[model samples]
Every structure is written in structure tokens, then in C-alpha cells.
Target: MPTPASLVSPRLPAQAAIAVPTSRIHALRTGARAAGLIAAGLGMLGLLGGWLHWPPLATLGAGSVPMEPNSALMSLLCGVSLIFALRSPQSARRSTCPLAFAALAVAALTLSQWASGVDFGLDGLLVQGGASPPPLTALAFIALSLGLIAMCKRGRIHTQLSEAAALAAASAALVGLLGLIFSVQSLGGETRSPPSAVALPSMLAVLALAAGMMSARPDGPVVSVLASSQPGAQFGRRLLGWLLCAPLLAALLQAGVQRGWVGGSSALALGVFIALAALAAAIVSSARRLNAAALHCELELGQLRQAAVVFRSSNEAIVITDAQANILTANRAYEDITGYPVDELAGQNPRLMKSGRHDTEFYRMIWRELHERGAWRGEVWNRRKNGEVYAVWQSISAIRDDDGSVTNYVSLLADITSIKEAEARLQHLAHHDPLTDMPNRLLFANTLERSLAHAKRHQHRLALLLVDLDRFKRVNDTLGHPAGDRLLQVMAERLHSKLRSGDTLARLGGDEFSVLVADAGSREEIAALAGKLVANAAQPVWLEGRSVDTSISVGIAIFPDDA
Candidate 1:
């Protein structure tokens, strides 16, 4: 677990919060629901007019003829769907089944009327010739049905579905409105015909449906993404709005120009001016968002640069390796300690530094610990580039991906060669004499105990001699302590030279020494060795450019005989 301070990055407070903003989404959804209700009202009005045979209603419905029962029925179904959309969004989301069935029925009746001049059993019951709905009406219903299907199947509107639904509704409205305008305009021309009967109500209904769908959930994935404080989302949302409005605006502008209500040149200039204004708004918004993103990236880059600085300047060696234990890179300290350049180590296995002091089982144990615990730390002996084996204290950690698979390994090591050497020197000094560099009494006693046990087990005799230097204090008092020390070293060397390879010689203190002669055949042999040691010590008299006389008194003990 990380501390709270560690969880937060000091450099990036702006990016710390990830919660979505909902104010814009709520406003958009409310507007869409309101539009859907307005569309439903218009549809109902059209339905009532066509059923009551009122001329005003008929004009809005079937353009001077009463709407056929089939047309009225389809309008009623669309009105119901819009009402469902407004009242119960969740139920409306899953209401595609009924809407699809109704759309298919409307499509079938319209096709029958278009192809065979058949009325689908309503020939005599409603107004005759103008009963069939226009092709755009069928298309509108199909688009709505598809939109509903998309919404229901996905359970929630995603990006692609929202785009498709918005495009379908926008296209339906554009086609119907454009067709109605053209029909009205053509009335003033030589060729005069009534507008398609389905135009007004169907256009209004689909527009309402599109608005409702867009506002169904203010914080839905589509709206949330589009309204986010991100450059790409802002640009895309603006672009989509421009595309939806551009065709209708252009068509209206062209109609005004053709009707002489506006000059063509003036209209073209106005269109261009409006387009540039929209483009400027989009650019400014995108620029502001992108500037924020750039600043965020710069802060992150600074942090990375700081981390790089620390990595390069650290005293300890650091190595990074791939999953297979091949070295990828090493820091400057690694190069200094290992005596290998970064380039030389690259693409080479870490085993190239193995000292061969540890057996294969040792390496196997290291790998096992790493796999189980994701890290291993201990003292390891590795060979330097100059072929010298040196000790290092190393820690290796596994770096893993989000899925918990190992991706890389980071090893941190420090050379402990000097420390190990110091520890060995301290241990030797603890059990040896400082002046003569000989085993002290503590070590000699341990050796004597072991020797005595061995002799008793093998049924052999061992002899011990304790020698005390005579007249050594007089030389130290007259010639100085340095001369006395040199004399002691010389004496120790002489005694050591006289002993057999298997014998032990140790300095007990200032001028007293002890020797252990193991496997001495008899007391006669021990007595002869003691006399020889005594004579050798008595002859050593050279010190400080003068002949200093030094003599020793020897005391001998036979281990089993004394016992």
C-alpha cells in the first residue's frame, strides 16, 4: 500500500481528478426531451386533422386530401413512440420491437399503393388517391426503427451508435424539409404540384425523436465524451454539428438566391462569412484545449528529466535487463564498478559476470526466490571485466505489466570488496598478536585442546613447551620499545623456523611463547626438541646495529605423561 503522499503526484494536480462534468449533459438532455414532446404534439395535431376531414388539418397532413387510415395509423404509432421516449426512457430504449413492426407495416402499405395501386383493405374507407404515404415517410420510419434497434441492442448508446442515430435523424429531416421547400417553390413555376402529404408531420416527428435520443441521458457515454475537456472530442463534436447544419443552410441560401430575395453574390459572401466564423470558433476552442494538453505533457517531461538526472548521478550501480536476463543498459556507476562499458554489456546475459565461485544450485535458488517474491537481495560474487572476482551486495527486482507478467528486471548493486577485506583484517587481529603476527594465547589454547583430544584418541604422546625470554626487559629499557619489538619478532621467527611443519608456535604475551609438538615418539625426543629450541633462542642477539644479548628458559610438559 502506498502512503497518501505517494499516491498523488506533486507535479500534476490538474490531472489528479478523473470525475466527469455533468452540467452540459443535463442541459442537453432536457432540451432534447422538450423537443421530442413538441414533435409528438405536432404529430397528434396532424392525426386529428386527417381523421376529422378538416381542410386546415388535411393541408398539414395530406395536402388538401384526407389522410388514409394507414397514414393516420402510422402517425399514431410514431406519436406513441415519442411519448414513450419522453415518459419512460428505459422502456423506450427497449421498445424497438413494436416500432420495427409498425414501420414494416407502414412500408408494406406504402409499397402496395405505389406498385399495384392497391389500398391494403382501406381503399373505400379513407380518401382515395392521396392515401399512400410518401417514400420519405417510409424512410423516416425505417431510420427511427433502426435507431431504436441500435439503442436497445447495445443497452447503452456508444459513440458509433449515437453518430449513426444522429446522422439518420438529421438526414430524414433534411430530405423532407428540402423536398417540401422545393415543392412549394415549384408551385410558382410552370410545373405546379402539391407537396408530399407526409412532409410536415414526419419531419417534425423525426426531429423530435433525434433530439430526445440525444438528450436521453445527459451523462451518457456519447455526450460525456463529446463535452469532455479534451481537444479531439471538442473538434469532433463541433465538426459533427457543422456537417448536420451545413446542407440545410446551403439549401435555404440557394432558394433565397433563386427567388431573387437575395443576390447570388451576396448570399455567397454571407455563406463564406458564416463558415469562416464557425471555423474560427472551432479553431479557438481546439487551440485552448490543446494548449492545456501541451502544458500537462511538459510537466510530465520535466519529471522524467529529473528522474534521468538522479539515475545517472547515483553512486550505486544500476542495470536494467529484459525478461530473458539480457542486459539492455547500465548506468555510469555500473561501468565503473564492473570494469565493463555499457556497450560491451548490452545484449549480453547477466551470467557473463558470474564468478563461478557459487555452484549451479546457488543460481537456481536465486531464480526461485525472484520468481516467488518478485525480488531477491543478497551478497554475490561476480567477476569484473579484468577477470578479478569481487564481492557485491546486490538487489534485483522484477518489473511487471498491468497483467502481472514480468517485462523487465532492475538490479541495484554496490561493491563491498573493501568492506570484506576490512572485516577479515579485524577477525585476524582479534586472534593474533599485533607485534609478531603470531597466533595469540586464545588461539593457541583452542589448538592445544584439539591436539590433546587427537593424541588421546590415537594413543600417542604430545609435548608442550612454554619459553620465557630472559633479560628482554633490560634491552627494552636501554635500547627503546622499537628495538625490543624487533628483538621479539626475530625470536618468534627463529622459534617458528625450528618447529616442524605440523607443530604450533604462538606468542602468549610480551616475552613468553608456547609450542605444541604433536606425535612426539617419546619423552626423550620431547626433551631433545626443548633443548634445541632453548639453544636457538639463546643465540639470537642482533638488534638496532648492536648485538643485544637475549636468552630464554624453556619449560616442557608431556600431555599423557603429565596426566
Candidate 2:
């Protein structure tokens, strides 16, 4: 089990957060550019009309008022502000704010002139003689300026506020368009006082500028659904043109009747007929879309049900986590293998099971590979809930959403502890004696080679001893092989006891042994150890109700002196 300290601090570093910009955002950028360009072109034409004394460019017809130069200038500023914001969204405060503020100041001064009946000299700044833009036009410019300013900041709330301001500007622009279409000077119904008419070009410029501002942040509350490719969004898009054109068409029809261009009785009948036809068409389209959506939902539900069954019944341990790596769910096999119940595992980080065998860089590499390649598989050691450290072969995959952002991570782990243990056992048996539980000749030879290198490097002497039991074949022939095996075991233990702690003793074969003294002293010291081993074997023993006599011969070699 992970200690409390390890459990609290996870090993994997926090993943670097990223923003995946989708194609929808790119489309929005194109739309914004188009709207900005259209607005700027119209504003330029209106100014040219005033500067050159050409009324047709500023007005829709002979009776319409010309667009004031100040109104044209404001439109130009708003359009340029939008383009700058889009071009440098990261630095909009520095690049786009000044133009937005200038437009705001102009509109504010225009409003002040109207309210206080005082001339601020802001109207007709470019032309000597022309009516000032209408109060509605000034209001629209103010709303567009605020929207552009709001675009300079970033956040959900700021984006929503910007979209809302764009909507307000669009509403004001639409009102001006309607007023000009009806050829009315009144800002409201006929009962109210007549106000200066908003010029046609000014109204068009404001409308396009408002649209550009709305496009600045398509992910905002009002624009997200409009820009989405969902079924509902498709339906909404289909209905948008009809919703916009129907009311204007009706108003024009009513105006025609009032002007005696069409008879009133016939106009009313035609209006009712058109309204019914539109309603029927909308109903039919909505029914077809709803039916298709219902079928799609059913198909998805069936797929989800099958997936759930597979997830639950899988034999390998499976765990799923959210993008932040907090555990969201785990299968039964996962709980069983980890020794953690489902309830205890939920909301916990997977690092709680870390065995502390791997370093921090190991986990960093895992996360880096996972992020870059989306999948990783490797063997790792983890501690179970009961404090047993075990090996597992694990595979991990990252799941993403439509925008290519990581949503979740799913991992599968298979226990390989028994396999690892078997490998270790096999390795140990390859180099050790089976009967005596000691290093055999193979291990002794390897050890001697390593010791020789070390002694050569340090210029130290090493002593090698070859030991033999004299006349051991006679006992095996008379007392049988079992009696010979008993004597060899006894003699091996006696030789081992006579050696120093740092000395190595090994069984070469039947009744043959080798000893290595890695830290050899003087020649006298080496002879003394050899004499002790000889004396140790000279003692007699009784075996099988008969007295057996045993003796040993010892031969020695010194490194650098012999060989």
C-alpha cells in the first residue's frame, strides 16, 4: 500500500492544458471578416458621397436623407475596430481599443447635441451642408462601439455581454431601415414628434457592423447554437431566413394597401393565405426533422447498452478517469485485482497505488507519450490495498471529444505477479547446487573471474585452494552410494566452517571442493588456513556401525606468484 505521504502527492505531473480550435471557429472568423469589409466599404461610399456632393451614394432614393459625414466616420471606425480585434485577438486592448473609443465619443457627443439642443459641432464634420444622422443612427453607433470594446476582454461573461450589445445595435439598425422603408420621419408612431430620418447608407453600415461584432466570439451564449452543426442548429438555420423576411414582406404588403397600390380587401385575404401556407410548411419540415432525430437517438441508445454490458463483463481490470485523472469508475476485475472496493476507489487518483519503485521521470515519460500518441502500454509495479506489491501489464488510452479535447482516460491492467516470480526462481536455480544448497562450479568460476579482476586492479594477492578427500571411492564401493553422499555432505560443511567470513566455498564435483580467499594475507597466513582444513578432515568417523577414517589433501595457488 502507498504510505500516506505518497498517496497525497501524485507522481505524474499535471498535464499541460490546451485549447483545441475547431473548424467552426475558423468559419466564424471568415464571416467576421466579410461583415467588417462590407460595413467599411459602405461607410467609405457614404463619405465619398458627402465629400463629392453625390447624394445617390448616401441615400436610397430622391426623398431619403443623405448620410451625415459624422455618421459615416463612426461606421468606418466600428468596422476597423472589429477587423483589428479579429486580426490580433491576443492584443486587442492595444490594437482595437482606440478606434472603438473614438466611435463611442462621437456617438455620445451626437446624443448630447440632441438632448440638450446644443451644437457640439460633431455633426457634418466632413461636409458643409447635410442633416445630422438621426438619433436612432447615433444610438446604433453607440451600441456597436460598446460591443467592440467588450470584445477586447475575454471570458464567458464578457463574450455574452459583447453579443448582447451587438444584438442591441442590430435592433436599432433594423428600426432605422424600417423607418426609411416607410418614408417616415417619426422615430415612433405618427402621434410622436418627427425626428431626422436616418440615412439609408448609415443604416446599412450599422447593421453590417453589428453583425461583425456578433461574429467576434462565436462560442458565446447567443452564437454557439447558431454556429454549431447539431441537428437542432441545422433546423434553426433552415428557419432563420423565413423568420427574417416574412415580417418585412408583410409590412411592405400593408404599406402597399395603404398607398392604394393594392386593394385593402384583397391584401388582407392574401396576407392570411400566405401566413397559413408558411405555417403548414414549417410544420411539415419540423415533423420530418423530429422523426429523424428520434430514430438516431434510439440507435445510439442501443449502442450504449451493448457497450455497458461489455465494460462490466470484461475479465481484465479496467478503470476510467476524467480528464483531470480522478477515478470515475472501475470494473469488478479492477476492484478485485487492486484489493480496493468500488466505493473506496471512486474520486481517488490512480497514483495512490504507486509502489515507489519507479522515479518521477518514469511517470513524466508515460504522460508525455500518452498525450502525444493517445495510447501507451507497459509493465509497471503497483501496491495493492493490502500492501502487497505486484507487477501488472497495463494499457492506457485517451478519449477525446468532437473538438479534439481530451475528455477521459481508460486503462486496462492485467496481473503478472506469478509470471515474474517464476522467472526469478528459474534464474536462481541455474547457478546453485541442487543437493547442498550452495554455489556450484559454474557460480564459483564466475566469482573467481570477477575477484581476479578486482585483485588485479587494487594490486592485492588472492589465494586459491583445491581440497580433496583421500580414498573416498572405497567407502562408496563397500557402503554403497548413499553412504558416499552422506560423507560428502558432512565434509563440505566441515570445510566451509574452517574458512573466513569473506572466503568463498563451492562444490566442484563428487568429493572435490574449491575455496577462494579474496583478501589474502601473507604466505604464512595462507599456509595456516590450509593446515586447519587438513587437521579438520583427519578426525575419524563411524558410519553404518563401522569406523570410517577420512583424510584430505590441500593444494594452494597464489595470484601473481603462480599461474
Candidate 3:
């Protein structure tokens, strides 16, 4: 049977599998870039408002605290850093470090000035009358800088660290945003006097920075899990959206009551009811979908178990490998044919059984076919544990994931050593004489035709000599056919030894033999070779306790000279 191109698990229905769309990934990256741009634009507006005396641009509205000049500058630095962090790792690190460090330094210095009760010149450095950013805003900027730094580094731990920092910054910024929305008077009370609260624009900028950081590093564990197309992520996203929007909905109702559009108690009661109803509805919808998905997964798992059984019990040697071609598992038949146990073969590269018969280019073609067409089938010679070379008809298939990335390779190998041996034996018998173990008449004629063509093309000479054992009929009549057979074999070996390595010696039939001398050089060389053949044939050989002598008569025909 032909090996399956994709294994059972990969063949599952699209709905039953986790399909991470390439378009979605691209959207996430684009969103990250947009978020960075938005943060930078907001920062630039704040800087302009501070300089141009525009309250709306800096504070986002009348009676709101303005985003400090230092805060706006930090935001600008972080925005640039976040954008740079989205690039290739090497370039990201090189470009993002300076911006991230500058942001970190400014935020640290501002926080240090606040804690020590000192006026840091950094606050009013950009604007003459500007106050330092609120303590909460400075802390958020610090977290944002650290996150950008972590995002530029490689490894899962660094990714998780960056994600954690982004979440921390987002949470801090969200608190500031909530304070502004609810008009909370006590949110930033850090001194005898009311401390300057986190500005509306500053909070928004930090939120944008946090969002951009998370979106830029989609491979991070937290982002990957949240953005995944699995059932759990989808369900979690639904509940999360509801939770965020439900509070805002409740807050709007509270604002209406404060404005006297509704009774306070009635608004509170209605808000509770609405929140609970939405929660219950979301739960019901998610539960039904998840239950259906669970059933589908169960069916798929059962099918995979059956496939596993077939894989283990199959007569053909099967090997499963990771994308890197490291062996993951192999069937019993594989162990039997390769003479290696599963324990030893596991985690090993498939090149362990390579035979020297094929060159590097041969394996390159197989890999090329597998990548282009996802499958390849051909004969391969591999060495066994005992150093015996064996041939196998091998079929390899690449197994890909829902993302169209190759995840594993499945190789099915069937031993063809015995078949190859049988073919070789049949081929040899068809082209050779049985008695003297030399080329037969048919093979000799074909060889002569090919040699003549080669000689004609290259302007070379060739000699075709027909040789006969003199008085062979007398030996057959007196000493029996067995002695005559032995005499023919002996004469054939002697005649072959007298010619060059590129010569063909064939036994036509009975005492008749032919020799093809390719590239025969000159007439003198041909005559010398014939004399040597005659001298060697005259030598005696013992057969059945008696010495038998044989002589050969040669008739030469040169190509283009005598034809």
C-alpha cells in the first residue's frame, strides 16, 4: 500500500483542528504597528499642546490635568521602541535598546525625584511651567520600557517576561483611565496636597504602548494562547469581551443616575440585572459550542487510536520523525529490518543507516521532492547493524499542521533485498553462457553492435576475432562430452587473459568462441593479441585425472578495414 501523505490526525476535519489563519497573524502585526503610531501621535499632540497652550490636546478635555512634557517625551520614546521591537530580532535589539533605555532613565529619575521630595529639572526641561507626570504614569512608563527591552531578546522566558511587563503596564494605565472616567477625587492622593493625577492623554498613551508591545510579540506564550483558534481561546475571548464591556455599561448607567436621568437605586438594580443576564447568555452560548467541539474531538481521538493500531501492526517498516528528521517512533517491523531497537533509534537522525552506494545529491533530491510535493517514493540502499547492505522501496511523506507548516515526516519502507537479488540472477542468466560462464551469442552480438557504433563515432578501430578449439570433436568422442566441456572452459579463460581489460570474450556455441577487442589500436597490436591467445590456448589442463591439450584457430575482422 502507498504511504498516506498526511497521517490520520492531520486528515481530521478543519473544524476539529486548530486552524491559525495567516491573515489573522498579519492583522495582529498590523494592529501592533498602528498602536505604536497612535501612541506616538498622541505624544506628539501633547507636546504641541503644552508648547502652544492648547488644553484639549494635552489634557484631552477642559478641567483635565495636562500630560506633562516629560511624560509626552517618554511616551514618544516608548512608541518608537515598541515599533522597533516588531522587527527582526537582531535589528530590533540594536534599534530598540537606546530608546528603551532613555525612557527607562527618564521614568526612573522622575520617580526618584518624587520619592526624595526634590525637583528634578527633567519635568520642566521641555516646558518651563510643566509639572512632573503623576507617580502612577511614571511607574507605567517604567514597565513599558522594561517590556520593550525584554521583547527584543530571544527565548520563551524573555517573551513571557515581556508579556508580563506589558500586562502590568496595561493594568496600571487602566486604573488611571478608570479614575478619570468615574471622576474619582481620591485616586491619586499620595501627599498632604492632592498629588498630580495621571493625565488622560498619558493614561491613553500607556495603554497604547502596552497593547502595541503585546501585539508585536505574538509568539509569546500569553499572546499565543489568547490569540489561538482553539475552542478554549475563542470561549475565553468571548467572556473577556463581555466582562470588559459589562462594567462600562454599568458605569454608563451610574453616570445617568448622577445626571438625574434615572433614580440611583433603580439604575443600580437595572445595571446588576443587565450584567447578570449578559453573563448567563455568554455562558450558555460558549457551553453549547464547547460541548459540540468536545464531541468532535472525542471522535477524532478514537480514529487516531485506530490509526495507531494499524501503524504498529503493519508489515512494512514505518518510521515517524519530527520536522527536523529526528526519529520519534518506529514500528516493530522497522526494528526487525534495521536490526536496531526502538529505544536506540529514538531521537536519532535517519542518516544512521546510510549506505555508501548513493551520493549526497541523491538524498537532496528526495528532500526536495518531499518539500515540493509532500511525498517521495524510490528505492534506497541502507546498511544494517551487522554492516550488511540491503535495498528497500521507501516512501516518505511530510505531515503538516493547520498552519501549513511541516510538523513531522512519515516514512514507510519495504525490504526489497530478495527481489533485487532475484532480478540480478535472472538478468545474469539471460546474458551469459551456462557452460563456460561467459557472454552468450546474443549478448556478444549486442556488445559488438554497441562497440562498432562507439568506434565509428570516435574514429577508432576494433577487431572481432572468431576463435575455435582445434580437434575438439575428437576429444568429445574419445574422452566424453564432460572432458570436452572442461576443455572449452579452460580455453575460454586462457583466451580472455591474453587480451586487454576492455575486450569481451564470449562462447558462441560448442567449440566456437568470439572476442571483441575495443579500440584495437593498430594491425600489429591485433596480430600480437591473436598470437598471445593461440600460445595461451596451447597450454595443457588436467581433466578427470588426464592432461588435455587444446589449440585455437583465430579469424580477425577489423571494423572499417575488413567488414
Candidate 4:
């Protein structure tokens, strides 16, 4: 049987099932490892060159001096953490706690130096004259502290860690790169000036730490999200355009500074315009993605609402059940037809509707067919909540899962009680006289045949009487057929009252009837019944504001004697 399309369960949208791709995850891990190694190497080289006073590396130092011991120590801590993350992710995650503590200590020391101009004793051992910390050292420690705080969450790498690390690394790298480029430009035609002490190494260390933290865990939010096909991931990838544009913009600014073509106000305006444009692009992209997702959700919701409408408003009673036949849900028509409230019926078995009209075997057959073919359709007798037994045309089908295991069953029922009653009435009308409401001639013949066989088997006397109304046509012709019909109805009632319970009194035609007198003793007894029937017919019938007389002519036939 064909089931309604709306009856099936809804499925998840394809986009909703998307997950991060493996290839992208691999790329993230590789990038993080490479960045971490580069930062570790740069940190170690800068530390060693400064300590040993190596010429080639000393030229790259700030004011021709090596990095401060404390600043190099912080860089070494970040580099070591990144290296550990690259080697063992779980260990790296756990190592974030100590890293965060160390970063906080570094930030505190740097802040003290910035605020009080105090060397804190370490700068005196590392460099002569007890030089003060570079301006960028304070900012680098602040960025490191924030990145470590994000990374140290409950001793695990999380989405917050990745985002914070990325922002910290990007900001630190941009500041250092910009400052170094400006310093190099100033050296073009004049004496060379020293670069910031912490800028070069801090930038490399921050980038390594950020990349390492992002790829430290496969299940980390940033790596998983970036690897996925979600619109947000696509938008995030698009934001990488800023990373590419930053260097070009920095180069242009550096050139302008060198040529004295751009003032501070012009440069500030250029920066503001670029920032606003990027922000607008990001907002527009995010809005478009959100709109598409919202539209898809609305369409799915609309379909669900339409299906609910059809289920609630259907004329046929609908019931949904689990595989075990426990009622899960029912519609309004189910309540109307069964006279049971939905709340009362839920969780109950459908056997509550049993009317005792069908046996256990009948239900067994129904289930057998349902299991074999997944559907069964036929008429069933069920009881209403008011104790009224009624018939229904019911159809049942199984709802299966992808594995072909039955998950639920749906039943549709239409009340067929009126139709059944009408069918019985039609059968009766075909075999009985309409006017007198008695078995007609065709039915009388069949009764006579059965009576004859019974009498012959028992050696008893049987008699058949055909009673016809005399002057019946004259009465119809004068008083009308309605009066005639009324007279015939009265005669039938009178004759039926006089006959024995076992005897047959059938109206065979307009003015004729057949009576079967079984177990008669002799002809005299049969004649007496015939005379009585004639007397009953001769009585007056009151109809149509007048009394009309009707007479019947009786003819008798004996079973053996007539034969």
C-alpha cells in the first residue's frame, strides 16, 4: 500500500553533517611544527650569539648589544613549550600550566623595569652600564602572558587558546616587523641605529608558540573548525588576506617614511581606511553565510509545519506507535473516532480498542502479514471509549530504519460502521417486500424447499398456503396505491400475529403472500389456518383519514398428498 510522503521521519541536512577534513588537519600540524622549530632555533641563536659576542649575530642585536638575559629567558621558555607541543601534544597541553606561570613572572619583571627604570640586577650581568629593557620587551611579555593564560585552561588546549595565540603572535610579529623595517630605512643614508632588543626574537617565538598551540590537539576548536567545510571556516580562511596585505602595507609605509612623502595624519587615515574596509568585508561575508543558513532552516521548518497540519487535520484517524506497539502519538481524528483523549491513550497498547469481535487468531494473522510484508490493510472491529462496538477500515504499515529494522508503525483508520449497516439493509431489501416488510416470493420458495426436506425426513405433514387479496386492484384504482399499500401492511401484521413462531409468513407481491405451515396433523388443521388468515385479511385497515376493507383468497397445498 502507498503511504503518505509526510509520514516518514525527517533527516539531517547534508551540510549539518559536515566535519573537518583530514588533509587540512595535517597541513595545520605541519605548519605549527615548522613555525615552532624556526622560533626555537632563532631564540637559541640570538641567546648564544649575544652571550658569546659572535660578530655575525652581534650585528643583528639591538644597539650592537645582545638580548637581555630575562628577555632571552622568556623567549627560551616559549620556544621550549612549542618544541614540547610539536613532540607530544598531550604533554604539551599539560606543560601550559608552568608556561603560564613563567610568562606571568616575566611580564611582572618587565612591567617593573618599564615603570621604575630598574635593571632588576640581571641586565648588569648580561650587558655593561646596566642597560634598561627595550620598550618592546614590556609589550612582548604582556602578549606572552595573555597567550599563555588562554593556553593554560584546565591543563588542555582549547579554541580560546588557539584564537588568543593567533592574535598574540600576529600582533607581536606586526609590531616587531614594522619597527625593524623603520629602523632599516633610517640607516639607508646615515649611521646605522640599533633595533629593539626583544622585537626580532619575540616575534619569531610568538609565531612558533601560536602555531604550535593551534595544532597541538586534533580535537582543538581552531584546527577542527579550519579543517571543516563550514561557512565560518571559509570566512576565517578569507581573513588570511589581511596577513598577506599587512606586509605590503608595511612596505609602502616604510617607503613613504624614507622619502618623507607621508605625514603622521596621512598614515593614520590610510590605516583607518584599510581597517574599516576589512571590517566591512568580514561583516558582509558573515551576514551572507548566516542568511543562507537561516533560509535553509526556515524551509525545513515550513515542511515540518505542513506535515504537522496534514497529520492533525486528516479525516481518517491516524496513530503512530513504536515497534513494540506502544502508542507514541495520535491525531485529532483518532480522538474523535475512538472517543479517547490523546493524553489518555499515549503509552497504551492498541489492544485497548479490542471489541472482542475478532479472535486472537485474527490478530495473529494481521501481525504475521505485517511482519512479512511490512503492511496490512483490511476492515477491523474495534470498541470506542463509550463501549460502542464499531467497524473500521484500517491500514497499518511499518516504518523502518536504514538497516531495515522496524522502528515504528503507523495506522490509518476510517470508520466503516455506517457502510456495513447500509450493506445489510440492501441485502434485506433485495429479498423482502418493501411495502409489508416481509420475505418476498423468492425467499419463500427457498424456505418451502427446506421445509419439504424436513417433513420428509420426519414423516410429518407439511402444508403451503398462498394468500391473495381479492379486489386489491379495485381498491388501489379507487383509493390510490398508498391506501392499497396501507391495507396490505395491516393484513400482513394480522396474519403474522396468528401464525406460530416456527411458521413462515412472507409477503410475496403487491397483493400476495406465502405461509409455510410445518408439523400439521391433517388437511383439516391446514384448512383451519387458511380460513383464519382469510378472516384476518378481511378486517378493515385505517389509512389516509379513512377505513378500507380488504379480503384475501387462500389456496392450500399438502406436501405428500399434493405430490
The most accurate candidate by lDDT is: 3
Ranking by TM-score: 3, 2, 1, 4
Q: Residue 197's C-alpha lDDT in candidate 4?
A: 42
Better of 2 and 3 by TM-score: 3
- lDDT (10s digit) by residue, model 4, range 1-563: 11233235423244333445566667777776676676556656656666776634533543343445556666666666655555554765677557656756775776676667555765555544333446455555566556655554433345566466566656666666666655643111223245434345555566566666666554555555666767777777667667646766866876786788997678768877986898789879878997898898799878777778788888889998878898777888889999998889877999999999999999999999999999999999999999999999999999986457787899999999999999989999988898888898888889889999999999888888888888888889988888877788888899898899999899877788888988876888888888888787777777778777778888888888998
lDDT of 1 at 463: 90
Q: Candidate 2: where is the Cα deviation over 4 Å?
A: 1-21, 56-64, 87-89, 186-196, 247-261, 264-276, 323-326, 341-349, 359-373, 400-406, 434-563
Q: What's the TM-score of every candidate structure?
A: 0.47, 0.77, 0.90, 0.45
Number of clashing pairs, model 3? 0
What lDDT is obtained when candidate 1 is compared to the true structure?
Answer: 0.71
lDDT, each prediction: 0.71, 0.80, 0.83, 0.71
lDDT digits (tens) for residues 1-563 of candidate 3: 21223333334344324544666778888999888888888889889988998878897774578888999999989898888877788778798888999999999998888877788688778887887876788899999999988887887678878889989998888777666656654233543122337787888889888878888877766667668877778777777777657547866886798899999789878888987887788788888889999999899778777777787789999998878898777888999999998879877998999999999999999999998999999999999999999999999999886678888898999999999999999999999999888999999999999999999999899999999889999999988999888888888888878877889999999899999999887889899988998998888888778887778899999988996
Model 4 poorest 10 in a row by lDDT: 184-193
Q: What is the C-alpha RMSD of each candidate to the true structure, in Å?
A: 14.7, 6.7, 4.0, 16.0
RMSD of 3: 4.0
Give me the runs in candidate 1 sitting further than 4 Å from their true place: 1-303, 453-461
lDDT tens digits, residue span 17-68, model 2: 2221577778778889888887777778778888888888776454467777
